[model samples]
Target: MDRVVLSFGDSLLRSSDVSLLDPPRWLNDNVIGFAFEFLAASLSPPLSERVAFLSPEVSQFTKCCRDEAAAFLEPLALPCKDLILLPVNDNSGPEAGGSHWSLLAYVRRPPGFLHYDSAPGTNAHHARLMARNLSALLEGDGGFREERAPAQHNGYDCGMYVVCVAEALCEQHLRGCDDLILQSITPQYVTRKRAEWKDVIGELSRKSAVAPQP
Candidate 1:
């Protein structure tokens, strides 16, 4: 079967001008624009074969509820044998129904913000976590290894943590899938701002990273 590249996320990875409950459109626009571009660029065939983009527009009606986008990814989980591209029952075979080649690129605001209020804090944490997850997926390739990158649960991890994860994932897991390409496109300005946010959070993680966790 052809390898599949799944791009899954909220407005950040899906919509460009869509709105959430909160206002302050500039920040939201910036966040969503960056992800949309990244996925567009990264999904190039040479980088990956089959590409499936799941965004908030379609997600709003799904049972997963935009907040639980990750759970919606269950269908893409490939058994090891499939992920490795090896015939099942062979010496190099992986677990049954576990070897499908797929990558889940999720983008969204942080966990809280719905009940109380969410600002750049939620964006920052999610950004950090996204980098970490993407990096792990890229580095592990189709291996699905546990993530070892540092915790950027908050925005303080310098976004580099995510970059580092991506760099590593690209080096390992992505190597075997010759066609495995997972690039995240972002404009120079958004990229710069995200970096700036990371710096700010890094300096004040202990004092300012908290965002009324739900």
Candidate 2:
């Protein structure tokens, strides 16, 4: 997940004018809340204006109480013109194994929320729960939709899918397209991105080592 975020940030810098000077470099499954928060913070103007990201902590809090959750999210909602990416994790306990990652994207053109799950149907209930809370918080008429996104072939790649989907959506938004459907993200793409990330991280490490310490 850490490598993926760094790779995505580098991609953004290369493809566009977005500047991510100190992007998040390390994110593990246990600290996904921080991962989402870091993603939200890393976004720069124009792209940042097109999309907003809610932290996993907000999603977790919504599972407890919708009212309180609405209050909590009310202030964090960004004035995004296009979409809001909300990461959701539905796991009860440590004994229950690893948590699953999914996305709840609220798009503005058609004015509806779409849930993208790599494990399709696994997080439907959680998506609906979040939709309700977001509706109340945003004060929009409830119009939630579910689209089975490109599924992950492995257990650990859900976070990768989330980042990839967000990247695709941002690209689409930049092109002024409302068809928010994710086309496809193949294993080859993931493999290439992993290699690219390794190179990016290696360069960053070398640069840090050469810099004089104050």
Candidate 3:
């Protein structure tokens, strides 16, 4: 993972990063952040303008003071963004790492935050911290809830579930649908994503390689 194999904007994936997408290996910040970059880049203009995606690092920073969090989010135009996809990490207190992953989705239509945790209650605290800091800035949408989501069978797949759920939500919203349908994203589906993500990385890497650089 020392040598960079893919660099899309700020998301960088090293040569062996693709292996992290496979089972029994926990997907790190690189894979999740890159996946988000790919997904966000696929949205149409209007929908794109209304949606936002934050990396786990930035999302965790929301647990800080409101002013700081708001300042960090200012450029994203949070007020106008209806759907904010925040990947949450259950970091050990005052530590630099976390053992669990989840997602906190801020929706303007309902004016509230909804958390999707594949491990159920593991990430609830972190998700609420984000909601507490971001709700007012997100149009006084302080109401929060733990929404039902596709559960992962193994501990290492939580990050994958986060990526899948984010994709599902964005796709549904793009299609003018509100109901979430995650039944089809089974463990097998999650496992298959490794190949799909690798394919996307390969395509993007090729495009970047051919593009003229200054």
Candidate 4:
């Protein structure tokens, strides 16, 4: 069956431009380059036809300004056979307390669940808490089933954990089967990583096909 892959994420999921302020640092080139390459290879034919991406602009997806996002998505009558990728971009901008790092918006890094140092008790902190709470809810749901997708672990970094949890929350909300693929974004956020993600997604797709659909 065909599916829609609604990737509502941050700049990492979007096409990024290199920062001129930081010359000799080819961040965008490498990051976006790898992401696209990976996406291209992963979504070839059977899978590509099964999915369509629905990512909106910045203000629509930010932590403080996600009312529009909520409204927009609330009415999106998407097919049951779809995937959701929420790459928290909590580390983006000077407000989020990370001036140097740009995040994939909803994508998160599970490092002991720390809040943004600059904005204590802010909306971003609350949003992270909400996501964490939602993850726990999905993990304990009696009606929903769980499938352990490939874990993208590198050393002690638990970045992939955030993605995996988000996918679980989304699946529960959508009342869909728990079949997802998780991947981490390099600091630069390139397109080639999409190809890498696609490889992982391909594995999940095959597995999901055999699993009972929710």
- The most accurate candidate by TM-score is 3
What is the Cα-based lDDT of residue 141 in candidate 3?
91
Q: Name the lDDT value of residue 25 in candidate 2.
A: 24
Off by over 4 Å in 2: 1-44, 79-81, 92-98, 177-181, 197-214
* Model 4 lDDT at residue 114: 23
**Can you give the TM-score per candidate against the true fold?**
0.27, 0.69, 0.91, 0.31
Q: Which residue pairs clash in candidate 3?
A: none
lDDT of 1 by residue, 147-167 (tens): 222333222222223333333
Alpha carbon lDDT of each predicted model: 0.28, 0.59, 0.82, 0.31
Pitting candidate 3 against candidate 4, the one with the higher TM-score is 3
User: For each predicted model, how many residue pairs clash, with residues at least 3 apart or on different chains?
Assistant: 25, 0, 0, 30
Rank the candidate models, highest lDDT first.
3, 2, 4, 1
Q: Give the total clashing residue pairs for model 3.
A: 0
**Candidate 4 on 1-83: residue-level lDDT in tens?**
22322121222221222221132332322233333333424455654433322231222143434334444444433222233
Q: Better model by TM-score, 2 or 3?
A: 3
Least lDDT summed over 10 consecutive residues: which range in candidate 3? 205-214
